[model samples]
Structures are given as C-alpha cells and as structure tokens.
Target: MSATKASKLYILDTNVLLHDPKCLYEFKEQDVTIPMTVLEELDDIKDRKKNVAQEARYAIRSIDSILSKATNSEQITKGVRIILPGKDRDIKLGCLSIFPDHELTVRTGFLPIEHNKDNKIINCALHLQSTFPHRQVVLVTKDINMRLKALGAGLKKVEDYRTDQLVSDVELLPEGHHYLDTPFWEGVDKVESYQRDGKAYHRVARTLLPNTFLNEYIYDSTQDFAARTVAIDQESVTLLDLGYQHLMNQSAWGIHPINIQQAFAMQSLLDPDLDFTIFLGSAGSGKTLIALACALEMVIEQGRYNKIIVTRSTPPVAEDIGFLPGTEEEKMTPWMSAISDNLEAMHEQDERPQSSVKYALEKANIQFKSLNFIRGRSIQNAVVLIDESQNLTPQQLKTIITRCGKGTKMVCLGNLAQIDSNYLTPLTSGLTYIAERFKDFEGSASVHFQGVFRSRLAEFAEENL
Candidate 1:
C-alpha cells in the first residue's frame, strides 16, 4: 500500500496483529496505536505451539525492535517515528504509538474490567477516538463483533487492515479459461496447427487470448470444442497437447477425468516440470480425489516423488470437534476422512490385486501430517497436498510453502467459497491469495475447476439447497 497524502489513525486489535504481524507497517503515512491490553494478550499467547503464537512473538519482536530506537518513554507512549521499508526507499515515516488502558466505569452493555479482553481493547479505542478529534480514528480489526461494538460506541470508522484483498466478489475471480467468444473458426486456416503424439496442437496470437497465463486452459465452444493450453508466450498460445490429455482418461489409481478441468488438473499434477499447482473448486469438485490419484501415480507407479505428505488446516469445515484420540495419524484420520473415502473409492474401482485403500496407501507411502509440525523441516522428494487450504492464514501458507525443498512438489487444493476461518473471506483466503500472487510465476500454475464431478447429488446440492 502507498502512503496516503492525508493522515489517519488506525488502532490495532490483537486479532489483527495475530493475523498479520507486519500490520503496523501497513498504515504507511498514517499513525498506528497498539493498546497495552493487546500487548498483554500477546505476551500470554507467545509461547503456544500454533501459528497464532508465532505471530504474537513476531509482533512483539517487531515492536521491541522499534522501541529500542526510541530514546524515551514519552516517545514510546506519545508516539515514535516508524520508517516503513519500501521498494527502493522508505515509503513514508510514520508514528507508532502505545496507549495504556486505564480503569474506568462500566458503560451500558459493556463487559467489566479484568474479565473481557474485547471490552478492554475497545475501551482503549474509545479513549483514542476521544483523543484524536481532528483526525480520523479508525479501529482496525478482523473481529466483526469488536468492530460492531466500536461502531455502536460512535467510532466514526472501522476497517479490516488487509488492503491486499484480490477480489471482493468470488465470481469476479477468473476461471483460468474463457470461451472463444469470437468466430475463431473463420480464421482457423490462419491459426497454426501441428500433430504431436497422435493429438493436435494449435497456436493462436496472444492478442486474441483472454488475459491468460502459462498452462491456462483455453476452449473453443463456438465450434468443435478442444481443451488444454500447454504453452504460453508473449505473442502466442499453444493448445491442448492431447499427449497428456489422453493420459487423463488413462487410470491413475482407477480414477479418470470426467471433464476438461479435471484433465487439466491431472495433467499439471502428473507433470514433472510443474512444481507448484492449485485446484480451486467447490465441494465434491473432485479436486482432492484427483490430487490423491496423481500423487499415487507419481509416487507409487512413476517413482517421481519419495512419498505423499497429505495435510490440511485443522479448522473444522462447519462442525465442532470435542477431542480426538490415538497417534497423530490416528487423530488426523477423522480430519482426513475425505481422503480416506477417495482412496477407498479409487481402490474399489481398481481390478489389481491388493487394491484396498489401506494397501494402496501403504504402497504409495502416504503420510498424514498437521501443518503445525512442518516448521523448520525441509520436505524433499515428496508431493505435498494441502487440502482445505482456504482455512490457512496467508502467513501460515507462506511458512508451509517455504518448507518445500528440491524435488518436492506442493499442490494446494481448496474452495474459495468454503473458507470457514474467521480471519478469511473469499477475497482474502490463503487459497485466493496464492492464486493471484503466483499467476505469472514460472513452473507454477493455478487451475480453477468449473465443474463438481463428485456425483449428480453433490452437484445438485452444491448448486441449490
């Protein structure tokens, strides 16, 4: 974000800092306030083993780094100069202020002191609002209820601190492909076509393309419809190398592509050159199923990856879990029930001996892991599948991705519409964040599935009630 010509005071909430530690620097030219209660909460959560705890430690360390440069307590409390690191230089030097919470009488409908962290945080915001009468005092938080209370308390402005949101409407996000939309068949003679591996490859000018990138699927619905976009250049695009598209119908653990999107996903998944790929779709979209099948093919059949490390954010989809038992894999089995179901379905369809899901997983050398235990580890020669990726925060996703070592491929699968975390929306979900961020990155491709091939019942339920 660029520095604003005008100034605004943004009060930080604990969740905001926990969600993103670098949020203090996001204000640019504006000032930021960190309430003492937020610091207290940070101190309490800094030692836990989860991502939030790590964020707390990071926020504290950042604050301490800035505070060490301040000469006096007055500067620390009143406000100290903070230089924001920019692309080439400092975007703008801003002030980082620390506000202490004071004992106060209970307002109507407010929680008491020493009991509610939310009330304490808002009380400090209330104090800041009164202090900054000349400037806008906006409470920045990821908590909807906290913002509502602050707004009810007559705070004129409150906003979500994340300004890097890609798309407000989920539908506005591109599907990685678009219909020909024009009479391309009339000019088909001019378009270059060649035969490769018993299938056809056609080339079209980039000007006629629909803002596509590497490996993005292109379709011609107007005439004889074809699929796949294997190569993209500055001036032209290459169409379906059915060499790989033909393999989509070939069995991968007894699974076949039901549509072109699945074929594209399977192609990317099985390709040795594509190191990173994403499959975005709704429930019963066959994303997880296809990823697992390809992982099995690469690891067990092709001997490409050492193993398959299947993982997902532990956040429940919609229900709640009281507790779980047994080993990490055992406890994680409930979370990975979808994976187990797909494996069983694939095994049942296979006619090979030892075709049970258990035998298939054993032969494939599959491992189930929680994202919590992945820190500081280099995962090499493995195909990692991060399911329910929408539940992960952006920072968490970055940490996981950075752990990928040489020969390791990571395929992130999630539905932007099924994000269940409080800190994320369709626009800001980690899945959506990576999809937009890696659009042009080499060896990385993002494919959005347009169909849910789980079953007619699932498709009907997804579309309707």
Candidate 2:
C-alpha cells in the first residue's frame, strides 16, 4: 500500500491490465483504483478466443473473485473495485460536437479503442482526478500516447507500466573502438590476441550494450573482468568440452555447435533466479534443442528443477488439435512434434520410449501444456520452455512470465525475422522486446544466431535468397 501511504491513487489503464492481469497484486497492499472504462474494455475482450482476450477475461474473473470474497459485493469482484466516475460528470469541453470521432479521439493524441470509447475513458479519468484534489492522482497506462496525454492534461503524475525491465543504472561506451588485453581471454579458447586497427575488442560479442551514463568508460576491463565491448558478433563456431577426457566420457549434449548456444543460454537462464528468460533465433539456431537439453540437465542431471515443462503457442501460431480429434495426446499430436523432434535429434536415437512427445510426456512426467490453460496456475521447480514466442504480443508475453512460480525457469524462443503476425513489427514483437529491455541486466544475456547452420541449402536460401 505504498501508493496509499503516499496518498497516490493509481487509475489502472486497460492495456496495463491486459499486459499483466496480476499487476493488481504487484502493488502489494497499495491503493489501486480501476477505471470503469477498463472494465468495459475487459468485457469486450474476455471471450474473443485469443490469448490476450483470454487474459483480459481471466484478469477480470480473478479480480471479481477477490472482491466478492472481501466485500461480499457482487458489483466489485476480485481485487478491483470498478467505478464509473463519468456517470455524474458532463463534458466540460464542446470539442466533440465540433470535430469528427477520429478528431475527438486524436485531439488528446491518445486512443486505445475507437474514437467514442477513447473519449469516454479520458473523460472518466479527468472526472475522477478532479474529485480527488487532495490525493495525488496518477494515470498508469501501457499505451504511450495515453500516458503523454495524461501528463499534458495536468494530472499529478503519469507513467508507463514497464514490467519487463526495470533498469536502475544506465551505462554507455564508444562504438567499434574498444580496449582489450590478457586475462580478457581467460575462460574462452582459440582467442588469438590480435587487435584490428581502430577496431575495439570486448572478447564477448553482442548486438547492443547497456546504455552509458555519468560520462564513464563503462567498458573498463581492469575494474570489471566481465565488462565486454559490443563491437564483435559471436560467430557460428564449433566447440568441444574444455576438459581433457576420453572421447566416450564427454557428454554428447555439449558436442554440437548448436549446444554452444544452449550452453550460453543455460548459463544466462540459471542466473537472476527469476522465472523467465526468452531466447530468440532463426531455424537451426539451437533454441528449442538447447532449451530441451538444458531442461533435461537441470531436471535429470543437475537435480535443480523437479520436472520438464514444454508448451507452444497454438496456431494460427500453433496447430489446432481440436479439428484432428482423438485422446488428449492425439489431439496435441502435431504441436508436440517440435519437442519430440528436438529430443530425437538431440539423443540421436531412432528408437525411444515413445514416438510422440505426448507419449513422452506421460513417460517423463513432463507437462506438455498449451498457453491457453496457464492463467491462474503458478508453475514451481520446473524448467518451462515456450516455443514460437515471436507470435506473442508484449501483453501475452507478460502474462506467461508472471505465471512462473518460485524455482521455475521459463525459456521463450522464436525467430523475430520469421514472424507471421500481421499486427506486429520486429521492434514491437515479443522476442526483440525482451532482448532490448533485458540485455543489460546482470542475470540476462541475448544472442541472435545470424548464420543458418541447420543445412547448407537452408543456409544458402537464408543468405542468397
């Protein structure tokens, strides 16, 4: 209840709730008030059969349930207390009568819905803020334009709901020009200590580095051993286990070039101790394979997690098992093949316990869940892999990440360049969204697989065509 203690009343925006339904709990004993317009938007999105819609539906249901328990008032259910402040308020400005619907909606320069709904929502916020002059009234929205308008309207405060990355300290470095020396190549091998003229080396390669601040050389290798420059991109290199061992003693898991990506991913995944880490790459980039291998090592080899949990976004994104018709396993046959194929390829065994991942699910006690049913449940001590994550929106991504319980590590993998969503672009897509946000965090690392390594034909088509 920090916001309450500070006398700050946050008006929950619809997109914020849709982005993360459980954000209500995030305040943790804080004063959060849901706008009546958010509820109306939720009602419309609740039964659309899409993940975002389903999330909207689930959030409202949860909030209603909590309120019902707390107050015994059916009107306000869940943790959210819906209020329509606009019921008594009249439009002070006559702009709507003079302008078209689009103009009215665009006048304030923010609209999540059609012109009419947008105006009503803004009006509702304006009315509520006017009533609570003593209290610090703030509008919390996921829509950028909405937040801008709220600030411009002379509200107490306005902020975006950034649930993904909360960057505390920002750091930046000069481009291409880097400084490197001995001990920088301590752990990595085949690192010939050679410097290109006017080009900097940071040993490790990355697409983007953390932001710079306070006029500091963020890439000081002497001070921080792990501080790396961003000039180099990791090449598709072959790797063998670092230790000297008999040929048969080495595990097949780390032998493949694909395994290198997974090994790096696993290293990052285990850190931060958070529930989720998203990995994005092209086909043959070892996203699914490494995730499965790492999950197996964690569950079976390392004894860190209790079970392996794998799921995919159903089409239009994942296959629809409903039309195929059979047992639960039979229904999930097509979608489960990705996991099975990765397992088969990893083990290099034609003969296994079960041909289908569904059967493997039964034998391994691994949960092959669909994203649709993961609303309220919190998965614990499990290695959860969500494939085809590129198809998800920023909102859908947040819902899944919030479902991770203590001791659970969730991995999301999909190719951003290979997107099929008509409504999203690369910058707005989930994969890039996560990468851009979390790249500088201590427990996170993002590597984009550039070259196609699956097959020569695939590589040729990727590069030439």
lDDT of each: 0.76, 0.55
If scored against the real structure, what TM-score would every candidate get? 0.88, 0.53
| Candidate 2 regions with alpha-carbon error over 4 angstroms | 1-45, 55-255, 258-262, 269-275, 317-330, 350-363
Clashing pairs in 1: none
The whole-model C-alpha lDDT of candidate 1 against the native structure comes to: 0.76
| Candidate No. with top lDDT | 1
Q: How well is each residue in 131-200 modelled by candidate 2, as lDDT tens digits? A: 6677766677766666677667666577666554333221221121123454434535444233455323
CA lDDT for candidate 2: 0.55
What is the Cα-based TM-score of model 1? 0.88
